[model samples]
Target: MDNSVLRHDMVDGLEESLDRFPDAVSVAMRSVPRHEFVTDGPYQNRPTEHRKTNTTILAPTAVGRLLSALAVEPDHDVLVVGAGVGYTAAVIAEIVGDSNVHAVDITRTLVYEARENLQRAGYEGVLVDCRDGADGLPEYAPFDRILVEASAVKPPRRLLAQLADGGRLVMPMGVGEQTLVAIEDGDVAEKFGPLSFKPLLVDGEQTGSIVRNRTKREDPEYEGRGWHAGHGWEQDWIDWEAHH
Candidate 1:
Protein backbone atom coordinates (compact mmCIF):
# COMPACT_ATOMS: atom_id res chain seq x y z
CA MET A 1 0.00 0.00 0.00
CA ASP A 2 1.13 3.53 -0.68
CA ASN A 3 2.17 5.60 2.33
CA SER A 4 -0.63 8.09 1.65
CA VAL A 5 -3.22 5.34 1.39
CA LEU A 6 -1.99 3.65 4.57
CA ARG A 7 -2.02 6.95 6.41
CA HIS A 8 -5.58 7.58 5.24
CA ASP A 9 -6.71 4.12 6.33
CA MET A 10 -5.12 4.46 9.78
CA VAL A 11 -6.61 7.90 10.24
CA ASP A 12 -10.01 6.63 9.12
CA GLY A 13 -9.85 3.70 11.51
CA LEU A 14 -8.80 6.09 14.29
CA GLU A 15 -11.73 8.36 13.49
CA GLU A 16 -14.10 5.43 13.76
CA SER A 17 -12.71 4.40 17.14
CA LEU A 18 -12.70 7.96 18.40
CA ASP A 19 -16.32 8.61 17.44
CA ARG A 20 -16.92 9.71 21.00
CA PHE A 21 -14.66 12.73 20.53
CA PRO A 22 -15.02 13.31 16.79
CA ASP A 23 -14.68 17.06 16.80
CA ALA A 24 -11.61 17.33 19.01
CA VAL A 25 -9.34 14.35 18.13
CA SER A 26 -10.14 13.44 14.52
CA VAL A 27 -9.09 16.87 13.35
CA ALA A 28 -5.71 16.39 15.01
CA MET A 29 -5.31 12.88 13.58
CA ARG A 30 -6.00 14.15 10.06
CA SER A 31 -3.39 16.86 10.32
CA VAL A 32 -0.40 14.70 11.37
CA PRO A 33 1.59 12.35 9.12
CA ARG A 34 1.59 9.07 11.04
CA HIS A 35 4.08 7.50 8.64
CA GLU A 36 6.89 9.98 9.22
CA PHE A 37 7.13 9.15 12.92
CA VAL A 38 7.47 5.42 12.26
CA THR A 39 10.61 3.51 11.30
CA ASP A 40 11.43 3.82 7.59
CA GLY A 41 12.37 0.15 7.30
CA PRO A 42 9.02 -0.93 8.74
CA TYR A 43 7.23 1.73 6.74
CA GLN A 44 8.75 0.47 3.51
CA ASN A 45 8.73 -3.27 4.16
CA ARG A 46 5.30 -3.56 5.77
CA PRO A 47 3.55 -0.29 5.08
CA THR A 48 0.27 -1.64 6.32
CA GLU A 49 1.74 -2.91 9.61
CA HIS A 50 4.44 -0.32 10.13
CA ARG A 51 2.97 1.21 13.25
CA LYS A 52 2.69 -2.13 15.01
CA THR A 53 6.01 -3.44 13.67
CA ASN A 54 8.12 -1.01 15.65
CA THR A 55 5.60 -0.20 18.41
CA THR A 56 6.47 3.38 17.69
CA ILE A 57 3.30 4.92 16.32
CA LEU A 58 0.39 3.66 18.35
CA ALA A 59 -2.70 2.34 16.63
CA PRO A 60 -4.71 5.35 15.47
CA THR A 61 -7.74 4.22 17.45
CA ALA A 62 -5.74 4.00 20.67
CA VAL A 63 -4.21 7.43 20.18
CA GLY A 64 -7.61 8.92 19.34
CA ARG A 65 -9.27 7.25 22.31
CA LEU A 66 -6.55 8.47 24.70
CA LEU A 67 -6.66 11.97 23.19
CA SER A 68 -10.42 12.08 23.64
CA ALA A 69 -9.96 11.15 27.27
CA LEU A 70 -7.32 13.91 27.61
CA ALA A 71 -9.75 16.66 26.48
CA VAL A 72 -6.76 18.77 25.44
CA GLU A 73 -7.36 22.46 24.85
CA PRO A 74 -5.50 24.73 22.48
CA ASP A 75 -3.54 26.36 25.28
CA HIS A 76 -2.86 23.28 27.38
CA ASP A 77 0.74 22.39 28.20
CA VAL A 78 1.11 18.64 27.75
CA LEU A 79 3.87 16.24 28.74
CA VAL A 80 4.20 12.88 27.02
CA VAL A 81 6.17 9.93 28.44
CA GLY A 82 7.53 7.08 26.33
CA ALA A 83 7.38 9.23 23.21
CA GLY A 84 8.62 6.38 20.95
CA VAL A 85 9.10 7.85 17.49
CA GLY A 86 7.05 10.96 18.44
CA TYR A 87 3.86 10.18 16.50
CA THR A 88 1.60 10.83 19.50
CA ALA A 89 3.45 14.02 20.33
CA ALA A 90 3.10 15.17 16.72
CA VAL A 91 -0.63 14.52 16.68
CA ILE A 92 -1.01 16.15 20.06
CA ALA A 93 1.17 19.04 18.93
CA GLU A 94 -1.23 19.54 16.02
CA ILE A 95 -4.21 19.63 18.39
CA VAL A 96 -2.72 21.83 21.09
CA GLY A 97 0.02 23.39 18.95
CA ASP A 98 3.71 22.44 19.15
CA SER A 99 4.71 24.93 21.84
CA ASN A 100 2.68 23.00 24.40
CA VAL A 101 4.02 19.52 23.70
CA HIS A 102 7.04 18.19 25.66
CA ALA A 103 7.99 14.59 24.98
CA VAL A 104 10.54 12.20 26.52
CA ASP A 105 11.78 8.65 26.03
CA ILE A 106 14.27 6.50 27.98
CA THR A 107 15.99 4.91 25.01
CA ARG A 108 18.63 7.03 23.32
CA THR A 109 17.92 5.54 19.93
CA LEU A 110 14.20 6.19 20.28
CA VAL A 111 14.82 9.73 21.48
CA TYR A 112 17.10 10.44 18.51
CA GLU A 113 14.61 8.93 16.06
CA ALA A 114 11.73 10.83 17.65
CA ARG A 115 13.52 14.14 17.32
CA GLU A 116 14.36 13.46 13.66
CA ASN A 117 10.85 12.29 12.89
CA LEU A 118 9.19 15.29 14.55
CA GLN A 119 11.55 17.63 12.73
CA ARG A 120 10.88 15.95 9.39
CA ALA A 121 7.14 16.15 10.00
CA GLY A 122 7.40 19.86 10.79
CA TYR A 123 6.52 19.42 14.45
CA GLU A 124 9.38 21.53 15.71
CA GLY A 125 7.63 22.52 18.90
CA VAL A 126 7.94 19.10 20.46
CA LEU A 127 11.02 18.89 22.71
CA VAL A 128 12.33 15.34 22.61
CA ASP A 129 14.59 14.22 25.45
CA CYS A 130 16.35 11.05 26.53
CA ARG A 131 15.29 10.59 30.16
CA ASP A 132 13.43 8.36 32.56
CA GLY A 133 9.73 8.41 31.74
CA ALA A 134 8.81 7.66 35.37
CA ASP A 135 10.77 10.67 36.65
CA GLY A 136 9.35 13.07 34.05
CA LEU A 137 10.77 16.43 32.93
CA PRO A 138 11.01 18.56 36.06
CA GLU A 139 12.47 21.60 34.32
CA TYR A 140 9.11 21.94 32.57
CA ALA A 141 7.01 20.84 35.50
CA PRO A 142 3.44 21.69 36.45
CA PHE A 143 1.97 20.58 33.14
CA ASP A 144 -1.72 21.01 32.44
CA ARG A 145 -1.90 17.42 31.18
CA ILE A 146 0.39 14.36 31.15
CA LEU A 147 0.08 11.22 29.06
CA VAL A 148 2.06 8.05 29.67
CA GLU A 149 2.27 5.80 26.60
CA ALA A 150 3.30 2.76 28.62
CA SER A 151 1.55 0.78 31.35
CA ALA A 152 2.41 0.87 35.07
CA VAL A 153 1.15 -0.90 38.17
CA LYS A 154 0.58 2.46 39.84
CA PRO A 155 0.92 6.13 38.91
CA PRO A 156 4.51 7.30 39.25
CA ARG A 157 4.60 9.84 42.07
CA ARG A 158 7.44 11.74 40.41
CA LEU A 159 5.32 12.13 37.30
CA LEU A 160 2.13 12.91 39.25
CA ALA A 161 3.89 15.70 41.16
CA GLN A 162 4.53 17.45 37.86
CA LEU A 163 0.83 17.98 37.07
CA ALA A 164 -0.83 21.29 37.85
CA ASP A 165 -3.84 21.28 40.15
CA GLY A 166 -6.90 19.72 38.50
CA GLY A 167 -4.64 18.44 35.75
CA ARG A 168 -5.20 14.95 34.39
CA LEU A 169 -2.62 12.17 34.06
CA VAL A 170 -3.76 9.61 31.53
CA MET A 171 -1.94 6.28 31.92
CA PRO A 172 -2.56 2.58 31.83
CA MET A 173 -2.25 0.87 35.23
CA GLY A 174 -2.32 -2.78 36.39
CA VAL A 175 -0.25 -5.96 36.26
CA GLY A 176 -1.64 -8.35 33.63
CA GLU A 177 -4.75 -6.57 32.37
CA GLN A 178 -3.98 -2.88 32.37
CA THR A 179 -6.65 -0.23 33.07
CA LEU A 180 -6.66 3.27 31.72
CA VAL A 181 -6.40 5.52 34.76
CA ALA A 182 -7.14 9.21 34.69
CA ILE A 183 -5.73 10.80 37.80
CA GLU A 184 -6.98 14.25 38.69
CA ASP A 185 -5.21 16.23 41.40
CA GLY A 186 -2.14 14.72 43.06
CA ASP A 187 -4.16 13.05 45.80
CA VAL A 188 -7.01 11.13 44.22
CA ALA A 189 -6.85 8.80 41.20
CA GLU A 190 -9.66 7.27 39.16
CA LYS A 191 -9.69 4.13 37.13
CA PHE A 192 -11.46 4.15 33.79
CA GLY A 193 -11.52 0.48 32.82
CA PRO A 194 -9.53 -2.54 31.68
CA LEU A 195 -6.80 -1.56 29.23
CA SER A 196 -3.70 -3.18 27.78
CA PHE A 197 -0.38 -1.56 26.99
CA LYS A 198 3.34 -2.25 26.79
CA PRO A 199 4.66 -2.00 30.34
CA LEU A 200 6.39 1.24 31.14
CA LEU A 201 10.12 0.67 31.61
CA VAL A 202 12.78 2.86 33.19
CA ASP A 203 16.42 2.07 32.59
CA GLY A 204 15.07 -1.14 31.09
CA GLU A 205 13.50 -2.00 34.44
CA GLN A 206 9.87 -2.28 35.49
CA THR A 207 8.59 -0.14 38.35
CA GLY A 208 9.49 -2.43 41.23
CA SER A 209 8.25 -0.52 44.26
CA ILE A 210 5.09 0.73 42.61
CA VAL A 211 4.13 -2.74 41.45
CA ARG A 212 4.89 -4.38 44.81
CA ASN A 213 3.00 -1.80 46.85
CA ARG A 214 0.05 -1.90 44.49
CA THR A 215 -0.03 -5.68 44.54
CA LYS A 216 -0.09 -5.81 48.33
CA ARG A 217 -2.73 -3.09 48.49
CA GLU A 218 -4.97 -4.93 46.04
CA ASP A 219 -4.43 -8.40 47.38
CA PRO A 220 -7.65 -10.04 48.56
CA GLU A 221 -5.74 -12.10 51.14
CA TYR A 222 -4.12 -9.00 52.56
CA GLU A 223 -5.35 -7.54 55.81
CA GLY A 224 -6.79 -4.56 53.93
CA ARG A 225 -9.34 -6.64 52.03
CA GLY A 226 -12.14 -4.12 52.43
CA TRP A 227 -9.94 -1.28 51.29
CA HIS A 228 -8.73 -3.33 48.35
CA ALA A 229 -12.28 -4.24 47.33
CA GLY A 230 -13.36 -0.61 47.44
CA HIS A 231 -10.44 0.19 45.17
CA GLY A 232 -11.96 -2.12 42.49
CA TRP A 233 -10.54 -5.32 40.95
CA GLU A 234 -8.42 -7.65 43.05
CA GLN A 235 -5.08 -6.70 41.61
CA ASP A 236 -3.41 -9.49 43.53
CA TRP A 237 -5.56 -12.02 41.73
CA ILE A 238 -3.52 -11.27 38.64
CA ASP A 239 -0.96 -13.79 37.49
CA TRP A 240 1.97 -11.93 39.02
CA GLU A 241 2.61 -14.95 41.22
CA ALA A 242 3.25 -17.15 38.19
CA HIS A 243 6.12 -15.00 37.01
CA HIS A 244 7.54 -14.41 40.45
Candidate 2:
Protein backbone atom coordinates (compact mmCIF):
# COMPACT_ATOMS: atom_id res chain seq x y z
CA MET A 1 0.00 0.00 0.00
CA ASP A 2 1.04 3.63 -0.49
CA ASN A 3 2.46 5.70 2.38
CA SER A 4 -0.61 7.93 2.61
CA VAL A 5 -2.86 4.95 3.18
CA LEU A 6 -0.34 3.36 5.53
CA ARG A 7 -0.08 6.55 7.54
CA HIS A 8 -3.83 6.76 7.93
CA ASP A 9 -3.99 3.11 8.98
CA MET A 10 -1.26 3.59 11.54
CA VAL A 11 -3.06 6.55 13.08
CA ASP A 12 -6.32 4.65 13.08
CA GLY A 13 -4.65 1.69 14.80
CA LEU A 14 -3.09 3.95 17.39
CA GLU A 15 -6.40 5.71 18.10
CA GLU A 16 -8.14 2.36 18.35
CA SER A 17 -5.59 1.20 20.91
CA LEU A 18 -5.18 4.48 22.76
CA ASP A 19 -8.51 6.08 23.53
CA ARG A 20 -7.01 9.45 24.52
CA PHE A 21 -4.83 10.17 21.49
CA PRO A 22 -5.36 13.87 20.82
CA ASP A 23 -6.61 15.01 17.43
CA ALA A 24 -3.40 16.98 16.99
CA VAL A 25 -1.30 13.90 17.64
CA SER A 26 -3.42 11.81 15.28
CA VAL A 27 -3.11 14.38 12.52
CA ALA A 28 0.65 14.64 12.99
CA MET A 29 1.12 10.88 12.87
CA ARG A 30 -1.02 10.58 9.79
CA SER A 31 0.92 13.24 7.95
CA VAL A 32 4.57 12.17 8.45
CA PRO A 33 5.68 9.34 6.16
CA ARG A 34 6.93 6.43 8.25
CA HIS A 35 8.37 4.80 5.13
CA GLU A 36 10.64 7.78 4.51
CA PHE A 37 12.16 7.45 7.97
CA VAL A 38 12.77 3.71 7.73
CA THR A 39 14.33 2.67 4.45
CA ASP A 40 13.16 -0.91 4.51
CA GLY A 41 10.07 -3.08 4.13
CA PRO A 42 6.46 -1.93 4.27
CA TYR A 43 5.62 0.46 7.07
CA GLN A 44 4.31 -1.24 10.19
CA ASN A 45 3.70 -0.40 13.83
CA ARG A 46 6.86 -2.16 15.10
CA PRO A 47 10.26 -0.59 15.68
CA THR A 48 12.84 -0.70 12.86
CA GLU A 49 16.52 -0.12 13.47
CA HIS A 50 18.64 1.49 10.82
CA ARG A 51 21.55 -0.92 10.39
CA LYS A 52 24.21 1.73 9.77
CA THR A 53 23.67 3.81 12.95
CA ASN A 54 21.86 1.29 15.11
CA THR A 55 19.22 3.95 15.68
CA THR A 56 15.74 2.50 16.07
CA ILE A 57 12.67 4.29 14.77
CA LEU A 58 10.25 3.79 17.63
CA ALA A 59 7.07 1.77 17.14
CA PRO A 60 3.87 3.62 16.23
CA THR A 61 2.20 2.85 19.55
CA ALA A 62 5.19 4.18 21.50
CA VAL A 63 5.38 7.32 19.41
CA GLY A 64 1.62 7.83 19.54
CA ARG A 65 1.51 7.36 23.31
CA LEU A 66 4.45 9.69 23.91
CA LEU A 67 3.07 12.39 21.60
CA SER A 68 -0.37 12.13 23.15
CA ALA A 69 1.08 12.48 26.63
CA LEU A 70 3.18 15.45 25.48
CA ALA A 71 0.08 17.30 24.23
CA VAL A 72 2.11 19.55 21.98
CA GLU A 73 0.57 22.85 20.91
CA PRO A 74 0.81 24.33 17.41
CA ASP A 75 2.64 27.47 18.46
CA HIS A 76 4.85 25.85 21.12
CA ASP A 77 8.60 25.47 20.81
CA VAL A 78 9.48 21.80 21.24
CA LEU A 79 12.73 19.87 21.58
CA VAL A 80 13.04 16.25 20.49
CA VAL A 81 15.87 14.30 22.13
CA GLY A 82 17.27 11.32 20.21
CA ALA A 83 15.90 12.42 16.87
CA GLY A 84 16.86 9.14 15.15
CA VAL A 85 15.47 9.43 11.61
CA GLY A 86 13.53 12.61 12.54
CA TYR A 87 10.10 10.95 12.41
CA THR A 88 9.07 12.31 15.83
CA ALA A 89 10.55 15.69 15.04
CA ALA A 90 8.66 15.82 11.76
CA VAL A 91 5.45 14.77 13.48
CA ILE A 92 5.94 17.49 16.07
CA ALA A 93 6.73 19.95 13.29
CA GLU A 94 3.48 18.95 11.60
CA ILE A 95 1.64 19.86 14.82
CA VAL A 96 3.65 22.85 15.89
CA GLY A 97 4.95 24.89 12.96
CA ASP A 98 8.13 23.47 11.41
CA SER A 99 10.07 26.45 12.72
CA ASN A 100 8.99 25.65 16.27
CA VAL A 101 10.71 22.23 16.43
CA HIS A 102 14.34 21.48 17.25
CA ALA A 103 15.83 18.01 17.39
CA VAL A 104 19.18 16.78 18.74
CA ASP A 105 21.06 13.50 18.64
CA ILE A 106 24.46 12.41 19.94
CA THR A 107 25.20 10.17 16.97
CA ARG A 108 26.41 12.35 14.14
CA THR A 109 25.32 9.76 11.59
CA LEU A 110 21.78 9.77 12.92
CA VAL A 111 21.75 13.57 12.92
CA TYR A 112 22.72 13.73 9.28
CA GLU A 113 20.25 11.01 8.35
CA ALA A 114 17.51 12.76 10.30
CA ARG A 115 18.25 15.98 8.48
CA GLU A 116 18.16 14.22 5.14
CA ASN A 117 14.95 12.41 6.00
CA LEU A 118 13.27 15.55 7.26
CA GLN A 119 14.29 17.40 4.13
CA ARG A 120 12.98 14.62 1.91
CA ALA A 121 9.75 14.58 3.90
CA GLY A 122 9.42 18.33 3.25
CA TYR A 123 10.21 19.26 6.84
CA GLU A 124 13.54 20.97 6.16
CA GLY A 125 12.61 23.81 8.49
CA VAL A 126 12.81 21.46 11.48
CA LEU A 127 16.22 21.97 13.05
CA VAL A 128 18.14 18.71 13.43
CA ASP A 129 21.34 19.19 15.41
CA CYS A 130 24.26 16.94 16.27
CA ARG A 131 24.69 17.25 20.03
CA ASP A 132 24.22 15.34 23.24
CA GLY A 133 20.51 14.94 23.89
CA ALA A 134 21.25 15.59 27.58
CA ASP A 135 22.66 19.09 27.05
CA GLY A 136 19.65 19.94 24.88
CA LEU A 137 19.52 22.93 22.54
CA PRO A 138 20.34 25.65 25.04
CA GLU A 139 20.63 28.05 22.09
CA TYR A 140 16.89 27.35 21.68
CA ALA A 141 16.36 26.93 25.38
CA PRO A 142 13.20 27.27 27.42
CA PHE A 143 11.23 24.98 25.14
CA ASP A 144 7.51 24.67 25.68
CA ARG A 145 7.78 20.87 25.49
CA ILE A 146 10.53 18.24 25.45
CA LEU A 147 10.21 14.62 24.32
CA VAL A 148 13.05 12.21 25.07
CA GLU A 149 13.03 9.03 22.92
CA ALA A 150 15.60 7.17 24.98
CA SER A 151 15.17 5.77 28.47
CA ALA A 152 17.27 7.06 31.36
CA VAL A 153 17.88 5.78 34.88
CA LYS A 154 16.63 9.20 35.94
CA PRO A 155 15.69 12.53 34.37
CA PRO A 156 18.65 14.48 33.05
CA ARG A 157 19.16 17.70 34.99
CA ARG A 158 20.27 19.61 31.91
CA LEU A 159 16.96 18.83 30.22
CA LEU A 160 14.92 19.91 33.23
CA ALA A 161 16.97 23.08 33.54
CA GLN A 162 16.29 24.00 29.90
CA LEU A 163 12.52 23.79 30.10
CA ALA A 164 10.47 26.99 29.87
CA ASP A 165 8.91 28.17 33.17
CA GLY A 166 5.80 26.06 32.70
CA GLY A 167 7.17 23.62 30.12
CA ARG A 168 6.56 19.89 30.23
CA LEU A 169 9.31 17.25 29.72
CA VAL A 170 8.40 13.63 29.03
CA MET A 171 10.88 10.74 29.11
CA PRO A 172 11.13 7.05 29.86
CA MET A 173 12.78 6.80 33.30
CA GLY A 174 14.62 3.87 35.00
CA VAL A 175 16.51 0.62 34.15
CA GLY A 176 15.21 -2.52 35.85
CA GLU A 177 11.85 -0.73 36.15
CA GLN A 178 11.10 2.01 33.66
CA THR A 179 8.19 4.42 33.74
CA LEU A 180 7.15 7.35 31.58
CA VAL A 181 7.87 10.40 33.71
CA ALA A 182 6.60 13.85 32.91
CA ILE A 183 7.98 16.89 34.67
CA GLU A 184 5.68 19.87 34.45
CA ASP A 185 6.77 23.36 35.47
CA GLY A 186 10.24 21.76 35.91
CA ASP A 187 9.57 20.91 39.55
CA VAL A 188 6.40 18.85 39.59
CA ALA A 189 7.19 15.35 38.24
CA GLU A 190 4.63 12.61 37.74
CA LYS A 191 5.19 8.98 36.80
CA PHE A 192 2.83 7.82 34.09
CA GLY A 193 3.29 4.08 33.57
CA PRO A 194 5.69 1.25 32.72
CA LEU A 195 7.67 1.92 29.57
CA SER A 196 10.48 0.11 27.74
CA PHE A 197 12.96 1.94 25.55
CA LYS A 198 16.59 1.83 24.49
CA PRO A 199 18.92 3.48 26.98
CA LEU A 200 19.92 7.07 26.36
CA LEU A 201 23.60 7.32 25.42
CA VAL A 202 25.51 10.33 26.62
CA ASP A 203 28.95 10.07 24.89
CA GLY A 204 28.89 6.76 23.08
CA GLU A 205 28.30 6.16 19.39
CA GLN A 206 27.83 2.89 17.57
CA THR A 207 30.78 3.93 15.41
CA GLY A 208 33.39 6.71 15.03
CA SER A 209 35.35 8.69 17.70
CA ILE A 210 32.76 8.39 20.45
CA VAL A 211 32.94 4.59 20.49
CA ARG A 212 36.76 4.70 20.15
CA ASN A 213 37.03 6.95 23.22
CA ARG A 214 35.42 4.32 25.42
CA THR A 215 38.21 2.82 27.56
CA LYS A 216 36.07 0.07 29.00
CA ARG A 217 35.76 -3.21 27.13
CA GLU A 218 32.32 -4.29 25.89
CA ASP A 219 31.95 -7.48 27.90
CA PRO A 220 29.23 -9.27 29.82
CA GLU A 221 30.72 -8.00 33.09
CA TYR A 222 30.28 -4.41 31.90
CA GLU A 223 26.65 -4.98 30.95
CA GLY A 224 24.92 -3.85 34.15
CA ARG A 225 28.06 -2.53 35.82
CA GLY A 226 28.30 0.67 33.82
CA TRP A 227 25.95 0.19 30.82
CA HIS A 228 22.52 -1.35 30.52
CA ALA A 229 20.86 -3.02 27.53
CA GLY A 230 17.46 -1.31 27.72
CA HIS A 231 18.65 1.73 29.65
CA GLY A 232 22.12 3.12 28.91
CA TRP A 233 24.41 4.51 31.57
CA GLU A 234 23.19 2.37 34.43
CA GLN A 235 25.75 3.93 36.79
CA ASP A 236 28.72 6.37 36.64
CA TRP A 237 26.74 9.55 35.91
CA ILE A 238 25.60 9.88 39.51
CA ASP A 239 25.60 13.51 40.58
CA TRP A 240 22.49 14.34 38.54
CA GLU A 241 21.06 10.83 38.89
CA ALA A 242 21.25 10.93 42.69
CA HIS A 243 19.69 14.34 43.17
CA HIS A 244 17.05 14.04 40.44
Scored by TM-score, the top model is: 2
In candidate 2, where is summed lDDT lowest over 10 consecutive residues? 210-219
Tell me how far the alpha carbon of residue 212 in candidate 1 is from the true structure, in angstroms, after superposition: 18
Model 1 clashing residue pairs (backbone): 178-195
Every candidate's lDDT? 0.71, 0.80
lDDT of 1: 0.71
Residue range 1-244, candidate 1, lDDT tens digits: 7776766666666555544665757677767776676545322323222333234456556676677777788889999998887888988898788989999876676777789989999998789998878889999988999999887767888888999988999988776667787888754366656657766664523322244434444543664544232222223344557866
RMSDs, each prediction? 7.9, 4.8
Model 1: lDDT of residue 81: 92
> lDDT tens digits, residues 72-102, model 2?
9979999999898888898899999999999
Model 1 Cα shift for residue 153 (angstroms) = 1.3
Q: Once model 2 is optimally superposed onto the true structure by TM-score, how far is the C-alpha of residue 237 displaced, in angstroms? A: 7.6
* C-alpha RMSD in Å of predicted model 1 compared with the true structure: 7.9
Poorest 10 consecutive residues of model 1 by lDDT? 227-236
